[model samples]
Target: MSQTVDRALSILPLLAQGPADLGQVAERLGVHKSTALRLLRTLHEHGLVYRQQDQRYRLGARLFALAQEAVENLDVREIAHPHLVELNQNCGHTVHLAVYEENEVLYIDKVESRYPVRMYSRIGKPVAITVAAVAKLLLADLSEAERRSVADKLDYPMYTPRSTPGAAAFLKELAAVREQGWATDLGGHEESINCVGAPIRGADGRVVAAMSVSAPNVVVTAEELLTLLPLVRRTADTISREYSGSNRPKKV
Candidate 1:
């Protein structure tokens, strides 16, 4: 990249951290005051930076508008679908992509297994929040207070004997899931179904979605399914990179 363009682009993040005066900007960029002024002026003309009455430079309104527009237009499902398909093909099991919204974790996309014993779930269906791997991964990213509040309000149905039984247990599960950065459902939702999941993060490192791979115990034992954790995590990370515009997604 050209030095001029790189220097101009660097100002946006600096100003985002906080406004800075001309000398501070120039010092940070390791450039002379005149060169820094030129860069800042160019950014100002493009409405990417603002000059305050206090003489500090800050990110401009147009930059914010563009950021919001880009975020609003980003479809996590669209970006993750092909990756999900690739995962299913590799593992020969059901793969799911889910997101938390309005206090619910819902499946936003799924790729079915090639085998006959497929998991019965649909797009937009709210997950078994107390026991699903995808739900655990999504909810684990919530702040402690948010997770506690959500845990307290949810019904702890005995989807299976292994399912999370109450708020305390569910909270404990979420805490572990958060610390470990991954989650699993070992016959918790259904007696024979097992799942492993990983969180898909945004550029800011917050969980924006989760992806999972699942199969019946007959097809893949819980231990065998657990072995897929690394693959699931790799796929999730790839989707995250592509969705967050950090790096191009690679072949799984």
Candidate 2:
């Protein structure tokens, strides 16, 4: 990319943090005041940045409108199906894509397990939110207060002896999920099933969805399933980039 375009693009994120004066923008970009002014002027004319009477600039309405429009048109399942399929093929296990809706985590897509012993789940089914790996990832994205509220109201059914027993344990699990950027379920929802999952983030870096791979303990031990976590995360990242319309490749 050209230096001019790069510098101009850099100004958007700066303004997004809050309005900034000419000197601040110049310093942040490591460019001279006049060069910064030129970039800001171009952005202002394009309605991506707006100048206030205080001589500071912030993001413009046009940017928000464009963002909302793009989000409304994004069909996450359409963008993610192929990646989920690829993950399923690589792991030879059941793969799932899920989103939080109406206060429930719903499986939006799934690929059947290649083995004869398939998981008893289908697309559009509400996940076992209290203990499912994909559900943990989706719920972990909620605010602390929101997580607390949800944990308080949920029924802690011991789907197995390993299922979340109460709000405190569930909240702790969510906190760990938040810190780790991924989650797992080992005989939590079912005594014989295991799952590993990663979050799919949007351009703003918020979790928009999650994907997981699952198999029966008879097919693969928990330790073996975890070895696929890196692959699961990579697949999720690929889907996130396509869904967010980001062309930049992941750096090592």
Candidate 3:
């Protein structure tokens, strides 16, 4: 690496330990005080470092802002949207993408069916945690302690007779989902609706999000819905590959 770029990058890890004075930074970098000061000035101009009231240098607000922006840009919904649409086209049913964040599972993307009969759902709405297939898939990936904690905290609304009744049942269901690597909500969230979901994993093989296919019971029986499981799993796997950059175009 170029010496200037190398020196600038080195400052970040040094500051991460704790704020440091100019002399300390210079000593650690094994550079002249003037050289360290010049480097710090360049970093400050880019908002990568800050000079505090105590005159020590620390990481800057801009660094955090940039980190936030990077996370937002890596949205799984954006990566999964087209796959959801393609799955919807193949199955003729509603397709949804969801993620668990801040103790809530919410729909981030959706592709409505072309059929006259369709399920009523909106993107960005929090899921029925006890009964949504996507919700189950997302929650199933959490550790046992986190699963129990979240299960205890949820309201087990009886939207239907098939809805999960309490934490014990919910935990049991999550265990089944975790074991199977996929999930379903058959007339649980809505008496007329059935859903099947599979986890979309990151490069580390952790479920970062989930996608589901939904069809009204009036349109398809639970057995028929189950028939789509392979397709759903395939689509989820495709999204996981793309999101993890495993499918990136190879250089010539």
The digit string of per-residue lDDT tens for model 3 on 1-252 reads: 699889978999899899999999999999999999999999999999999999999999899888667545655777888888999889999999888987899887789987899888886678999999999999999999999999999999999999999999999999999999999999998898999999999877789999999999888999999999999999999999888894333442
Taking all chains together, each candidate's TM-score versus the true structure is: 0.68, 0.68, 0.69
Report the Cα lDDT for residue 247, model 1.
36
Summing lDDT over every window of 10 consecutive residues in candidate 1, give the lowest-scoring window.
243-252
Q: Which portions of model 2 miss their true places by more than 4 Å? A: 1-74, 246-252
What residue pairs are clashing in model 2?
A: none
Give Cα distance to truth, residue 49, candidate 1, Å. Answer: 48
TM-score of 2: 0.68
**Pairs that clash in candidate 3:** none
Candidate 2 lDDT, 167-220, residue by residue in tens: 899999999999999999999999999999999988778788999999999999
lDDT by residue (tens digit), candidate 1, 1-252: 798999988888788799999999999999999999999999999999899999899989997688557544548987998999999899999999888986898887889999999889987678999999989999999999999999989999998999999999999999999999999999999999999999999877889999999999999899999988999999999988888795333432
Cα lDDT listed for each candidate: 0.90, 0.90, 0.91
Candidate 3: segments with Cα more than 4 A from true spot: 1-74, 246-252
Q: Give the candidates in order of TM-score, highest first.
A: 3, 1, 2
**Candidate 1 residue pairs in clash (backbone atoms < 3 Å):** none
